[model samples]
Target: MPQVYIVYMGAQHASRYPTYELHLNLLTEIPVNCSPSESLVSSYQRSFSGFAAKLSIDEADKLSKREGIISVFRSKTLKLRTTRTWDFLNFSHSVNRNPPLKSDIIIGMLNYGIWPESKSLIRDWDLRQRNPVANIQKSEAVFDSEAPLVTSFSSRGPNLITPDILKPDISAPGIDILAAWSRVASVSNLPNDTRVVNYNIISGTSMACPHVTGAAAYVKSFHQNWSPAAIMSALMTTAKPMYPSAGQDQLSYGAGQLNPAKAVDPGLVYDAGASDYVQMLCDSGYNETMIRIVTGDSSSCSSSTSIGTARDLNHPSMALHVQSGKAFAAKFLRTVTNVGSARRSKYKAEVRADRRLNVVVNPSKLRFLELNEKRRFTVSVSGGPLPGNSTAPATVIWSDGKHLVRSVMVVYTDFSS
Candidate 1:
């Protein structure tokens, strides 16, 4: 059966080459005879170079093997994870605002919905399509006392794609979020329902995403030159740690709740550039060609590596999964760049783990003379054969009196894997 498949070719290398023609040429090269032009669904040339086309599973597999092609996978139906947002995060309106610079940061995401004549998805309304909103009532909003608890819908991980890397780097307000609504679309999305409202409450990963995006932009407003990784580190390091409860494991809330105020001054950040990620992919067993498909870079991986390979990424969090019935020992190397306000800072490492897990950090103390000064450390986690479907949570905190840079670590023993 034919299905729409998206071909990923990474970032475009040159402007002169027409991506549409390139996509067609690849299609024509398929063993089966077919009109390449007719198969083309659309060319994604604006941001990155790729194309969508209707193809069978075999054709997609064949296309994935093509040169310059990074990946070819069938496009699946997307489920919108829906958000109470700001106040719950303790980021109230009273917080500092830097709108002029904040406006410059663009978070490009597809919150795809009906695009009315006006571009704003939020309050710029078109009442012509529905009954006029009755009133503009102003009132104090009620709060969810148990605000930051993990919703059942949130994704859990010892990341399947790359188990070494923890998924959901962080969490944000994503339940019962009152965001703007499209007047033309039914509020309940029911065919017979004709009700339309200016705003509607929602919950999901999508809602959580915007909350984090806004926090990132907020963090950017303060540190205009911070990289995505740096900003992420700030957020993760300064986050309020969450404890696992029933129905929740260590992987659940990532680096915990999104704390916008504290993120601005993370003190130390595990800054990573493209090369670091490239190295991570390399460690994850991706070849040179596969690396280019994802990164559009020619960086090569060497055999000389740290205690751990993919797990060594200068990431804000660390995770490791082992067989439930087998004894496991793993070491991870991490580097942190001082982004603190103080010119000279001293940090001490603190590791907290379960009785069943023995965790140690090498060079438990670090000293930095100036901003951007980097320090590297290694964490060794060793434990006995744990029972199946179990997890042990641990924390590594690097603190310098004023700032607490925390990294969450989890060791899972999953026989099912």
Candidate 2:
């Protein structure tokens, strides 16, 4: 007999009932044999096929990371496997132990799962099994009306020791999404072959991660030679901020929704190399030993890693809030490489200051860099020299003659010394 591996993919909670039922229906459609092993294998294939039918490759990748889904496959008979349960603790530990893998197709899934510590406070009160009256009371106890409901569900920062910064280097759609499911799962109440719909929506950083992953896949499919970092840079440079939803904060969406078409041909990408990240840590005040520990080069230490003075244009340490007042100055240096044509052209750097703060650009014009050549730029901010504490954001937009090239955020804070 040959080895077989089955993996399940998608969010774990029964809330994804529609998707589960779809997978079950797929299992029923597969041909069965007398052998139990073969039958089980058939069932797994049917279930995965059902999921694949409903999702693009990118969506499937996102599903694999969620608690309930199995993310990898290894079976002699199967060419590609899906939906085996993942060991997240082991997976996290393994990433620390090994270097990154080299592959032709690298699919990056970004989900902002709530901080494990914050889960108790923000667990969904509306889950079906909870007593409705009791849950309503509990909701009032846990959250205030002004507090955005779904914002906390986004993934957290200080991704400890992951090779790449754990944050959503970019954002996408992972929220109350409707897709395929398994019919046989007891939790799914829908009939097989029926396309069940989960109309109630969900929002979290998870909802946002897949949108960018799909875009990355699209870019990889087209530009097969690009590195993972390059692909990430392209997506970030070209991402758009989500328009203000009825009751959402800008922080929740980061740069906003993703535009894959724009990402594929970004006029210029803000590239960050390994050394750049190292320098960022150093500028932010980390010693060599501390840098090694934070970047996963060494074991954990007692003293906190210092984030000194320098801030990367894209560093996660800085955040701007509309109401808080704190005065600060930060600089971000970026190297922009033009992958396009060599013709010299004029490029302007524009800053779209949020209403709460004033921003000034030192050298607003960017000189042309030849194709394959790189250029560096710097930005600085002060919180309007106000009397009280306040904060706002400057959307630093870089543009060529035709379209906006890239936009990075400079968050301002006004805190008294």
Candidate 3:
């Protein structure tokens, strides 16, 4: 069967060139069950040299092996996360006094499920158990809450398109949000009701995105020169940690709820640049050709420009996906730039782990004497064997009497569970 595949060829620096010919030259020869012209769905060249085409499994695999091709994979649909009422997040109304909420990330795989009898699915009635939950009033369910609760309509996440990186850097209030809407639209989205008014309560990404962007802008207003990653690091490290309910972990809330006030003064930030990301891509087994496609430049990932493994990207959060059920150890090397209010401050590391996990931070104390000074630290995590789809959460905090820079460490057996 032919599936729509997105062939990633990296970035196309030369936008003036026609990408159809380039794509045609690469795919015209590939055997397709349909017409050759029909197989070429769309050519993308303004930003990248690639195309979306309908290809069978074997054809996609063959095209993926070709040089200059970064990746070839089937496309998956994703639902948008709902909005915050950020006050429900306790981010406060004054957070914007001048500007953020992009936090709801659909983590793990919890879909409504497709045709279970399809050959692609697990073809067994044994696994298809009936849900005990009743859906008698979903269309009539009222979402009126003053606190944070994952709604029944909370969106599900998709399969991982890349390794290591986690979805949704954070989470916010995504329920019972009062936001703007069209004046002519119905309030209840029912045909019988014709309430033509402006400003409707929404609980989707439309309002969720603004919460985070405003938070980022608030951080930018304070630190005019901080990079985008720096702002993200500050936000992640300063998020308020929460205890997960059943069937939830760090993946649900990410680096915790957004804290705009705390983020502006995060003592240190895990900084990353284009070069760091490029090095990570290269170390992860991608070649120079794919790197060129991604960077749109002649950036080389030689050994001399090393920063260690993908785990050493200086991300605010640390995660590990283990395949084996046996006891294993994971280590993350990170560098944090001191963005503290005082340069003479000294920060100490504290690790809080679950009973089944053991965590250690090297050089527990980081003392900085100059602004923008960088310090490196290593986190080594060891834990009891975890069953498939199991995850463990731990909290790592760096405190200097005044500021608390937090990072969530999660160890899971699978990203798609």
Candidate 4:
């Protein structure tokens, strides 16, 4: 099947040159599936000069070489709450809260399920269980608690699926969330429980997921062209690491708490694409055949030029499962593309970890000459494999003084259940 692409043209020159018309003419030559009756230009053209069009892989590559075309990228699907969350993030009351802008955005939630009666959802949600929790009410849920503490029940991870990569990438306010509920459902999913309410207090990663979804939508409202990975990187890199409570580790709160305000302008992002993830699976011992089964594409590790370990998957957080009770050494390579507004920005790395762990960042200094420029570095961590599943948590931060890009690193030994 043909896929959609977002075509971006070079900067406007003195010559207007009927740019829009030229783009349409080029599309007309391609073997597109659009009906002849359809107005391709009128319907597909974007307001910002970029146009979305469905074309075969070869057709897109062919168009990229055309004159005035700056770049062509495949348009991929991006997938995202009440958000009395403004005050929690210190948002100004003067900020515009227009329904028109909100209606254009969609925040996706996956949890035990949402109660339809909650006023926050406004009876405007679709309940679909063709495929796919608990009871925590407001009185028992604290509203103003310092977070980044993984809810006692919020699942933490050694990423059973892939131990090299961190799981639960970030945390958000999940406890005592007052949102719309299902009038047909009980407060808890227990078969014996028959309590029903229009709005109920809830908590868990499911609740946390929606909060982050709203934060992501908030970020997308500011940057429409950002990919899903970029949005995730923004949230992960800009997360707050302040310890909300004791015993919080990378496994507990991957990159830290969700900081929506800071995410809008994350200085740099560790971006990845479909191929990057395919390689990650490859490194996780998934052979080319198995990889195809998951990705639904023949793009196998054999053909992919950029092969990387699961730890080097361009993820915003790093978690390594070290051999238990034995000292170990590990190194993680990461690349960050400059996304800040400055023309030239410099960053220095600073690490904070337990005294037993020795962490070092090679070439601690990074200088980006232009926007979108990427700089790569390696973080070497040693002195791990602590007793049992005990984790040695550390933070690797790249700061340009104006923006702090941080990644949570955890070196732990698996404790068998």
Candidate 5:
């Protein structure tokens, strides 16, 4: 099947001809503000308005109808009269109608800077609406909790209300990540193209999500039977929360960071099947008809919803969010698949709270699976005095029996209280 790529077009490049030349110049002038100045705001409005005026309504509608095209513009406050009313809805419907091309995978390319827009949609869909059909419960619980707060930098959820849930089910490392860029696109385009190899550092959960996606691809290549839901479960349950050291403010590092190896071998993963999401929607007040509409099946309700089980609540994405708070503590979980054999491993956690809060894993070990087998684990803030509001540096450490696998910084701030 033809691969479908979904790229977010932030305000910087919302126009049709989003050339790098224009983007760079715009970047230089646009001030980073919650509410931009009138002149700048007006300029943006004029630019998009002009762009909209140039296109015939049909053409604009057609562009919006393209598969994988969704609104990634930030600030619901912005007046995107034409695009929001029709263009966006058209795009959403088109993607919903078309099945993925017979490709081995679907890749979604997102820019972290586009998060504000993404989150706006999610917040509205997941939190605001009642009788919603998407998995808003998980997101809602996470949003209310203090843990990481869904990386203020990442986009929010409640992607769409009907015809298959489309919220961001999980997160990945899309912040300050080093990735390859196209030299032709980076260098040949106007200003500041000095770097070779076309490599650049971009941040956002967008960077993080791709890491998980790539790992999922690897898993799929080996195990084709595993469904997308399974892959998502594995990734979500296996994530780690990285925090800053004492005397620091909460930084962007969330869930400690992504661990591909550990994720691949997580012992237990919080799974969310289709019915689980359906039930979550139901709990949020959706009825059978709403579920059918959201799941693209208006026929009879599936039996999965009839047999209520606690397993349905197993969602690591929600779990981590519920556990970790903003009080200078970080927590995350890992997921692993059962390759062939099941092994038991002893896992231990230790916390060092002082000038900085440090968590270390002891015996750094798990015993399961053969040479190529995998298992999952969860690391959390088991014990620690909540940090004061004053900014401080914090540290998180993960160690295996023989080696220190990773360390992350947790930044703190005293602004709120």
Candidate 6:
């Protein structure tokens, strides 16, 4: 059987026809019977500008050269299942045990829905016996332990929307997780299955979102006044590096895996304000009227507003794409705000990069005189010709010896040989 593949054509560049019409035209042009006769696997017009269709290796190759096409790849099947999440993240021991009130915070999860009957979610005694915290035992033996790893199915990225800012600000445990299940539906999602269980094991990026959502709620519980960006900063900065041997980049496992404990007190944060994002949108070539429509304000981009790149956004991690010459050089401007104790808040910059690249930080030493105080710094990277078309990976750590504010830097340069 011809396998299904997703043919991503990027954003619509065809102005003459509608999205569906364009897809129809493209399919018609191809020799494959992609119309109703053969049937398309799926059309991704709403979420993404792509379509899934059954294509032979040769047909897919031929279509790859089609105008506006970005990438053509085989559709992958991802597997699931999880707990040992909290234990793996060291969330059980490092943080307080008492769970926060469910009413105060709501963890929003974009997952395969929930199985209310799972003991990990709601114990039977809690419902029937009216015991609130009866089966709540934070023991290792009860929850099976495994070496923490990034799921193969979990998505990785060199963030498409904003290449400068890394997507998936942080990571969380979401493998072989035992959670509540939906009684009406089958566990494995097979149509013919006829089993209904209270608890089911599942995994995937969908489950990962909820874990971080819960952690964000936990952080919100402690710092109620913090903005969404600040909470995000805390999570990313406090995340624990994962599978060092894996040799992954920021795009691979983003800010490492989630650490709910250290996140609560991330000494410092690179916070982005609402206005800053608005400015970013403006810099992205959005007109004043369009910006107003989105922001819901009469906010206009004026001469006073600096027209900087997306990397200017005060994010925890840095990904700068430099298109330089023979002597390639670029500078990344970033600012960090002290969010921890003012008395002992002092940090120094540490640079780690490939030998071919020369990374330097200005005013490497940063001293915080008060909480909420902001310090600005620039990372200047100057390197010779990249042997071939290659990306140079680097890291800058702002550490006070107590808190390590790590930033992953990827310099994509095309220097003249």
TM-score, each model?
Answer: 0.72, 0.51, 0.62, 0.69, 0.38, 0.69
Better of 2 and 3 by lDDT: 3
Lowest-scoring 10 consecutive residues by lDDT in candidate 4? 36-45
Q: What CA RMSD would candidate 1 show?
A: 14.3
**TM-score of model 5 (CA atoms):** 0.38
lDDT of 2 by residue, 1-417 (tens): 223334455343343455445454433344222232222332222213323223334333444454545553443342322211112001121222112222456574544432323313335334445565542221111223332233534653323333122233555545444322222232222223233332323344444555556567766775676666677767766766544455333434555546666666766666666666676566555676887877876533234544433445344223432223335554554566665544575678887776645566657876774665667766665554433433244576667866576554535223354
Off by over 4 Å in 5: 1-171, 175-206, 244-254, 299-312, 317-340, 343-417
Q: What number of backbone clashes does candidate 6 have, counting pairs of residues 3 or more apart or in separate chains?
A: 11
Give lDDT tens digits, candidate 1, residues 299-390.
77766864247888889998998988888999988899998889898999999898889999999999999998999989999999989889
Q: Order the numbered candidates by lDDT, best leading.
A: 1, 4, 6, 3, 2, 5
lDDT (CA) per prediction: 0.80, 0.48, 0.72, 0.75, 0.39, 0.73
**Global CA lDDT of candidate 5, please?**
0.39
Q: Judged by lDDT relative to the true structure, which candidate is superior, 4 or 5?
A: 4
Q: Taking the tens digit of each residue's C-alpha lDDT, what string does model 4 give over 1-417?
A: 777777787444444555455556767766556631232322222224556666778888987887767888987774312336666655555545455555576656555565554545624434333442225343221244654356555677878888888887887878767666777775654333466787777765667788788789988887766788899999998887756246566777788778888898999999999978887887778887888889897867755355567898888888888887788988899899999989799999999887879999998999999998999999999994478857878888899999999888878887677
Q: Candidate 4's error at 309, in angstroms? A: 2.1
Position 250, candidate 1: lDDT? 67
Best by lDDT: 1
Candidate 3 lDDT, 1-417, residue by residue in tens: 799899999977554546667777788666677766668776765446778888999999989998889999898765434433444445556544332132332222222222334333345423456753434332332334433444434442211544455555777665456555565565654433456754565665555566777678777776777888899999888887766676455766678777787888898999999988888887677888999998999987786765456666778888776665789897888898988879788999998888778999999999999999999989999987888767778888999999888988777776442
Indicate the residue-level lDDT of 338 in model 5. 36
TM-score attained by model 3: 0.62
For model 3, the superposed segments whose C-alpha errors exceed 4 Å read 1-86, 89-146, 152-159, 182-198, 303-308, 415-417
TM-score, prediction 4:
0.69
In the range 237-334, model 6's lDDT, one tens digit per residue, is 77886533353555567778888888888888888888888887777788888989989988877788668878777788777555545557777788
